[model samples]
Target chain A: MRKFTILAGLLLAVSLAQAQEYAPPKGDAHNGAALFQKFGCYSCHGSWGQGTGRDGPRLNPPPAFPVVLQQLRTPRREMPPYVASIIPDQGVADIYAYLSSLPKAPDPKSIKELQ
Target chain B: MSKRIKRRQFLAGVAAAGPAISLISTTGTAAAQTAPASSIPPVPNDERSLNDMPPQTQGKSGSDFMIDVIKTLDIDYCASLPGSTFRGLQESMINYGGNRKPEFITTLHEDSAAAMCHGYAKVAHKPMACMVHGTVGLQHASMAIYNAFADRVPMIVLTGNIGNSVTRQMNVEWNHSAQDQAITVRDFTKWDDQPQSLQAFADSMVRAYDLATTVPMAPVLITADGDLQEDTIPPGMEKKLYIPKLKMRGHPTGDPALVQDAAKMLVAAENPVIYVNRYARTDNGPALLVELAELLQAPVVDSHGRMNIANRHPLNHSPRREPTFANADVILALEPVDIWGLTNYVADLIGRPDLPPRRNPNLKIIHIGSEMLLTKSNFQDSQRYAQVDLSIAGDAESTMPSLIEAVKSQITAAHKSRFAARGQKLHEMSAKFLDAARQDVAYQWEARPISTGRMVMELWDQIRNEDWMMPTESQFISDWPFRLWDMNKPWHTMGGSGAQGIGYNTPAALGAALANKQHGRVTVAMVGDGDFNMAPGVLWTATHHQIPILYLVHNNRAYHQEVMMIVRMADRRMRSNSPNLYVGTKIEGPNIDYAKIAQGYGMYAEGPISDPKDLAAAIRRGVERVKRGEPALIDIVSEGR
Candidate 1:
């Protein structure tokens, strides 16, 4: 279950990378973890930002600060456009740092196919 | 919130004069029902109704009025589960839609609801309405919708929603609401609509009906805002709305000039062969295909499917038509997924994709199929088309007749010499393909862990000549046994992987079984264990309704594709390896007891078949139980990447 959570989180992380712009200013994983939980991001994205919310996409694929800034400005499809006003740069940075801190999702083969 | 749409405006909105009833109560069910054949009763049976709850303040659209609209569309039952967002709409449905307002057959989970719609529509061959509760509902529905998309089942899905303000502010509303609702189903639906105005809703709806019913049909979505369900127009607007009927069929008249030229090759080639597929179940495709085959007295190989030509037909050639295929100077492939398969499988003898596609130096090709423009929905790139000397695009039903006409126009008894020499030689080769395929099954059954080949062949002996539906999984148990199954068309094998979603087969098979319930078709959904584990709860739906579906769980453990990739990795890296591919891929420890799981959900269950030899009997048992009108499961334990 924990492994799946990590995987789901990583999925979101990957998508987040694609959905948002890149701007990792040497993010601090510890600070990122704090902000992620504080914002209730885990409720839907699982403990590490994998999807759990009925409709939330994964959040681990860390978007660099530029991508985060971009998401705030130019939103696509259904995701609401967020601005620095709604989520500050440092805060977004912290979340990104926290997600990047988690181990990348292990490939099924690397772990051994379930027997 | 405005409970009322100003009366005069409501009057203007209503295209017709006010009905006899002046009261707009959502709770007055009995009173609002249009007692006679017309949907909601215009005159309320005030005395017989539920007077305890006050009429809904938001108001009820004339129930009979809405019923009047639904009636025109020939809608019968509405499928749904409880949700506050749709309460007003349900009320309006009963009241306005009247007799046409489908009595909602609610289920526990939204997935089952979608599957029920799948099964229902398969049998009905038309769209059935199923409404879910906004964002969360749509999310839950994603898996089933994916299956439906893969199965190519047409459904009209409605979801309850609150506007953005409500989704943002109100807790009850926000959780279920989405800013862009259609995003949930964009990958699966043919079209989706979120009309802001009722007029737009109605208009988009008519368009939706048209699009969904067209060829290559699948489900379409339309979000019904909570606000719209109960909003009443004046009185008589139902008549102005119209939904179009779905239709598509095309024909290419074989040019008489080309026919003569092609006939010279076809009738003169001693080893001419005919390849057939999905055309068998089509309108006149089967008969016309048969006529052309009989004209040449050529053997027809059901290369991709079953019974395009009846197995017992005298002119029906045997399965070992390979030599005929090989020796023929010219071969005609009709509606085959393998016309390309043949040339590609023998590519080394010809050429590769990097260069221009080259066919066998000795063989000529005539290819006939419908579409040239392909979509990613099925992962088939349009550029992969085989290089054929003559590739005709038209309905197999349409083109077959024309080709048959051409064959009749030229071939004579003297032309018997055209087919005799190669026909005898080819007959021997078919026996080889058939013998090899059969031995292949035997060889697998003799192997250690469970083999998919033995599993399907054994299962076939159990359910042959019965109504069976297999979700076409690309790598799993799909093509290996295509040699044995009586497949006449694509529908015979429910190719439920167009979207290639992993967890789609279980629910989809459940749906197809449900659709086939009354017809006494024992629907079989052969799926990977991973696929089954994803939505095993659908078993409850089958149990709930006594739907007798033979849910075969191909429990080979692990994501085989990934495992294979890892093996390839080791091979590419020049490292000697063992099948440690079973690392995280196999299911073990508290390994799932699929039989217990099925029985837990009220299905008759069997297996964990340790021996491949018993695979046939286990499948037979599951089919027998389901044939008796109860759901059943057979979990086959196999070892594969």
Candidate 2:
């Protein structure tokens, strides 16, 4: 089942890459951080897009820009549809850049509390 | 001996000693008259002289008899704040009766008093009394009373009333008095009464205890009228006032034929799954369930209304309920709080259209519980109805033994081998689920503004060896304890607040700790910031009463659940400029200092600690305080679930 999920995800990523006709504008990570909190995206996704599993999925190492935009416009599950009116194209690109900018979580072995 | 005979003997003894008491009094009077003028101290002008002394009434008041009734019922605690209407009863309990058996536990609010009873009963397995102050107090306690009623917990509520307007002293008494005080809570209570005489009060109290403790248990109220409580008992009425003997009723069991049929269904099925909620009433309850599951080699999904199964048990498939139900040939639910929500898949869509069953289309479902035995129309706690192949009306724990015996009679050698193979597969599945949960927690393990997962794991690591009781729910902490902790003891967890009330966690945890104090177990609870704010004064009550508990505030600085809902609402409306969504939902602007709040209440406390590195040491200090018989609190600035 894990293998099947990985294969399906790769195929979707390839299809989204082929379908995109234009590149998104470069985004500012600092401005994206402010926009993330302003939009209340941190409520479901954490303050850094680290999902709680109870409400939303993790977004660190975010998917391709087109896929994120598509999901926001028309959510497939319980997530509310975030149309362009609620979040413009620039806002989505900035949110993606902020998610990408987050540092990788430290190893559990390195944290004495976790051990 | 009858109380009447004892009263008569006491009166006769007083009559026999009357001459001796008169002679001593007359001698003292003569001696006072002959005393020297210089030896007697002169009275101050401000104080009244001895000649100005007035007469005072002296004898047992009606409240003395009420205290006797309470003592007869063997109630250990009475949780209440002082009120005027029951002031007579309170005085009698302390001075006349010595207040040993039913010690008064002072509380800051009536809701906390009632919720204390709610939490205490789950661990003590017996009802504790809470005194409500007439109409206003009853209204204050109504929510906690409703929570206990919905949870099917037993408790006694004694409300004071001044039924006679003539005897009311002042404006406050008039305001507090009421004609039908118990009526406010009658819909939710199992039984209520306003007893007019001491004999009547004795009989009614025994009846209330019986009704409250029976299966499908709930809170019961008996109004103690102010006038009745203060007025002296008539000279010879003591003979007629006899305490009634309490007789406990046996729990109902499933019918023999129905039990046989249910057992047959389980034995014949290729894949059977057991679902349980609020099923374990005693330690023996979990043992019976374990026996039945082993007999059938079935996977048991504990819905956690109580600690129904060991978390590390091989047959416990709580984390894999969806897949287990999908493949199940036979499903048996024991005392399920919501059968429909468990079986169906309802999405939170725009319309929330009727969803089909998530289980196999041809699956046979059986339900056994006493929930249908007692219900009311005014409250809608009875969840949505779900159609089932078999419905047996009985207490699930009481019926489990009979069902297990029937299953044992039918098992053959061929069935044994098949069951063994199924058990092996389930054991492997349980191990994999635990490993996956461990892997999931490793994410964001060292993040600042500490992850709830890391906080919970740190606390678990400290207290896992100590005999500990967690009286609060785990939903706000992302249910990390359920996934990681090995909760084999019955008191390891006492499910959620039955009515989903906000203020239940703090007082209820303290109440459970009060019960755990005698058993020498460490009590720990993780309360949400929203829940803690509802009754922060409960911390003072815990400190005053010396009820030891380790309270961790999962301080997300927001009513985070509502934040998600508001976000959903905004996106659904396609609203632009949704930045101010946290107006009503967020608890920020000035984050509450829970550590100072706990300190002000005379409890040892630490933090607003956002660093995961500091959590372990702070939690250790709190645990050490609790171990030494003191209350403690730790505030962890954490992620929203």
Candidate 3:
């Protein structure tokens, strides 16, 4: 079990290193927004790419475009795999663009309601 | 004409007139009219006139005996809608029984009545009676009955039917009458009987009560025959009839040897996780689980079946089940509703293929629960089977003390330091998880259509200090309450509808509030728009009975869960999933005015409040009204999912 944990930690580190080097191809943000809703990405991930505790993870500062595409085609955990026949590569790229376009959430300390 | 007749004289006069009328008919009409005034005989002083008078009083009825049986079982309330088939029993309940113990609570629909019993049982720890008219009424209540059965909550469903076709008068009577009335809900309920005699009715009532209250409990049905309910107790038969004493059955406990084995595994494992659902039968359940988890310093994952643990406890890792389970070498599942779903991950894809187990493949599992004891083939409430290393057939809460004792006996001094270190690490992890949740909910925190997370936090801030209970499930709103609130009490939440049925929230919440009223607890619920619309009349029931609760409608204006599923389907087909997706699923075109509906039911209400800024004030007002013993509602137009 300890060996498995160490191996998992190493894999995560490699993924993080790879994430730093990757740069996504430029896509139209307007079309990306429409595509995000079209594919129903906003159902689990909220309309603004903010996720919920019980559903999806936060996607605003999304992982690398390759990682996102890989997850869509062959997903891990409970997410259903979207084969190439369903969502093409261009659609995945648009969704990535939409996620990247979302601004960072406001600091909770600055929000009076949260306080 | 000049003299008023005496009581005896009047009786004689009527007898004389009867003979004169017959004599007139026998003779010719012209001769009879001419002779009637002169030929009528003088009234006779007859002894039979005194004997012919009708008796002024009916001493006892069969329904009065039925009430006696109900009172004997100590059922607190009978929630019902008036129907002709049960009129005899209903009248006797109010008039003869004085509506005291097993008080009559009028509901607008039979479905609401059954649901009220479902919610009442979870908190009261006993069954309440739901009386319904036969056929149509039982059909109306079938979904709620199925919900109670699936939840393993005890309830007495008394349905009225005219078993004898001869006694059925109107079209409705014949329509409602059935040869076997219990058959409608027999598929779901644990036991059902249509008693032939009053003595049999008494016996069945006691038996049903005992069966319902036993471990692995479920709803039971007793069909009261309309004729039997209305008929007089036969001559000298009241003495023959007997109300049997209610037999209290002890909950099944695990075999001592097997319990010991489970304890040893839990103690020896490096990382153990206790997964629980519907395990907390009483307030003591949480304390027992706490003792067990702290002894081993194991993380506990509550599946929100009931309030199984204090949410703020450092060992509680509900929001982090995946990582906790991933590291677990041993798992002790306590009455899990779906053990297979918890241990394995299965995606709802095109073929619905089973994935590999989420936990360690060799992880030892110990199951302690009586879920298998009461199961039927027709309704599939029994979830898919999962193989376990040790299976103990017993009530988890009842078997907990012995398991705790066994673990104590096995633990050594060496284990204590290791356990403490494990506890510290878990505490740090729990704190970090909670901090992450706080950050996640901050996105769009000030949106115009209020975020469900912000809505939950605002409500929590106002009622955190009060003795509060949220009877409704929180899944629709991303389960923000479970993530954010400090839910320490047993009744803090009542879990979800056992069958995931819609229309459960409105009535069930009121039922829980009804139970909480006696304890002076402030009750709150957040219902979905679709659910509230299914049985909004339950608000009228709450207002009439004065069941205090703050009901907030999470009005997303669509069956949001269905909308998500439809979107997934469309995406799977590679079609447009949006804009047109709202066609069938949306609850709009003219959005429902829930505030107006609540006001019509005489409940204090506010909103269609859309702004996040306005939510806190509206919540405060609703809470105040609830505290003053009035039901209140706030309809918040909010984000879907």
Candidate with maximal DockQ? 2
**Candidate 2 local Cα displacement, residue B105, angstroms:** 0.6
lDDT tens digits, residue span A1-115, model 1: 5699799899867877775553366667787776554433443244444432122444556445565556535643223343455446777776777777765543322311110
What is each model's TM-score for chain A? 0.58, 0.78, 0.87
lDDT value, candidate 3, whole model: 0.84
- Top model by TM-score, which number? 2
DockQ (C-alpha based) per candidate is 0.01, 0.48, 0.46
i-RMSD values for every candidate model: 22.1, 2.2, 2.8
Q: What C-alpha lDDT, on a 0 to 100 scale, does residue B452 get in candidate 1?
A: 60
> What is the C-alpha lDDT profile of model 2 across B1-641, one tens digit per residue?
44233434533442364554334333433443354457668778568656566434535668877876776677889999988889888887766655655789989999999999999999888889999899999999999999999899989999889988988888998989888898889888999999988888888998999889989889999999898898777768866666666667798888889999999999999999999998988778888999999989999998788888888889999888788988998989999978887667677778986665456778999999989988998988998888888889899999999899999999999999999999999999998776666666776576667887888888998898899999998877777888877889988998877888888988888889999999889999999999999888889988998899999999998888888788778778876365576789889879899999999999889998988889889999999999999999999999886
Look at candidate 2 and tell me the lDDT of residue B600.
98
lDDT of 1: 0.59
Candidate 3 chain A least-lDDT 10 residues: A106-115
| Fnat per model, in the order shown | 0.00, 0.58, 0.45
Cα lDDT of model 3 by residue, B390-476, tens digit? 999999999999999999999999999899999999999998766676787888576545778888888987898899999998888
